[model samples]
Target: MGRIQMLNSYIDNLTMLQSLNLIDQAVSDGKHIHHSVVNAGKIVLMQKDVQLRESVNSADIINPDGQAVIWASKLLGRPLKERVAGIDLMENLVELAHQKGYKIYCLGAKEQVVSKVIEKYKQNYSKDIIAGYRNGYFSKEEEPGIAKDIAESGAQILFVAISSPKKENFLYDNRQALKSVNFIMGVGGSFDVVSGLVKRAPEWMQNIGLEWFYRFIQEPRRMWKRYLIGNSKFIFLTFKEKFKNKP
Candidate 1:
């Protein structure tokens, strides 16, 4: 797995299947792997958020979660293999856990959303695949306890569906407390999509990299600045880096 810099963040240039295999191997070996995925918005935020940058870059595996990221990599003369979306990867990992009989701990999202995701998983797979679950609400002081609980859950894999920075920071800060968990990754809004609270973009839209537009239309007021402004900033940064690296 080659790790390259894209928009100031390191991304692993691996296909979806390759990423899954790496994670499965780590889980099988009882080794800890902190996984993360970065999209356009997250990378734009990371440019100024030093802590967020550290948390995400420190991960053992970082995949390109946005097609924009793949395009950006190409523009910078560092073409990535493919986009390994967080949601898609989570869905695959859930199936992997079921096949391998590896328990998983679900964290983040609202109580109803997380519970619904767990229910869906149990319905689609088996109840034995679930080790434990918790909503994404907690005080700063409560983080250690939550990490301790997940660590002791006998879960070989952990999926956290919280928002950025928080999820990244939480996993990085409490990594020691979560050492018992073999594979940990932040899934962003995957719980919402899995629980049927949010609809995912169609395959065509996702392929063309307009998934962000699909999300923006759903909650324009909430996502306008994130998609519109953040995307513009990302474009500028990508171009600047491209020119700076030109021979």
Candidate 2:
């Protein structure tokens, strides 16, 4: 799949099904595919952060994780087919892992949250699909050992639930040690949702691209700066690019 430039990053023009198929193929072929995604907040940050930009764009597949990102792609004259949201894709991969009997490594989120997700998978799917799991509380110095542990776990897919730049940089930096893993992607806060600590927006709200608003409403204090400032910056950049390219 080819990538299309949108703002400061390039996004894979793949629908959810296409992304899942690619992952399935990679699992079958025993190939490693590093995947990540971009949302408005991440895009806003990437514009000013060089290392983060490099890490995100270095992915084998970087898809549109936010509705604004998909809309911006169309606005920028490179229409992405759809948004391959991180959480949904992770669930799809989990189901795939269950059917294919591929093991998975879980990293990030609070210990209880991650544990709940692991339990949910075992209860809902199968127990064998989980290779190992760890909370997202380790320091930077502890990362190398963490990578080594995951590599030795024989997991086929690794889903990291840590925040943006940290998760992005971790995967990018540990690419060599994680080469044994078949598919790697970062799924921010997905464990919380799965654990029922936070609720996702209604389907109607999600369809209308207001999931961020829903999330902001849920925890305004924690998410206010991220949604408000980040989204505003994204809007400004989108129109700036649009105006700059006017014929």
Candidate 3:
């Protein structure tokens, strides 16, 4: 496995297809895998969030979810093959689960969104492939129980779509309780994308790393600071690392 360090986190140097293949191998061999993803916002946050940094770096897979991350890796002397975006990974994994008869449990999004995703799977894939599902809202006290429920659901794959740090820490804290789950990943906002509540950026924009701008256009008030400030911070951090590495 190839990896490159960027600021406070390390990202797997994996293409989307390679990631899917690794996931398939993990499921087939019955190995437990805890997957994590990082973009600019996440990496910036990780610099000050010790637990976030640990949880992310400790995962079996840490994919670069933002195209900017791929560019940073390249500029800093560790060029990743490509961006393994989270939404894309989730979609591919869902299809993989369908074709392979692997059970999946989706945890996140509102009830309606998650329901739609589950229903989509039911319509397109084997009906029995959905082990169970629950929305992302829950009291902090309820986390352990939810983890237990997902563990007992007999799901081969678990996709969690809650917000950052929370989703990552939840999986990290309860990984012991989720031993029955073969592959677990925190897919932020992927449920909304899959359920058609939000449209992904067009391919050309995504290729040029303007996906954030597109998302900002969709929900400007909500996403502006995240993308604008977060992207700038990421660039600074990358250059900081780049200069630090110069001999």
Residues 1-247 of candidate 1 have per-residue lDDT tens digits of: 8999877699999999999999999999989999999999999999999999999999999999999999999988899999999999999999999999999999999999999999999999999999999999999999999998998889999999989889999999999999899999999999999999999999999999999999999999999999999999999999898788568
Please identify which of the two predictions, 2 or 3, would achieve the higher TM-score against the true structure. Answer: 2
Q: Estimate each model's TM-score.
A: 0.98, 0.98, 0.97
lDDT of 2 at 154: 91
User: Between the candidate structures 1 and 3, which one is better when assessed by TM-score?
Assistant: 1
Query: How many clashes would you count in candidate 2?
Result: 0
Candidate 2 structure quality by residue, lDDT tens digits, 46-82: 9999999999999999989999988888887889898
* Model 1 residue 86 distance off true place after TM-score fit, in angstroms: 0.4
Error of 1 at 26 (Å): 0.8
Off by over 4 Å in 3: 245-247
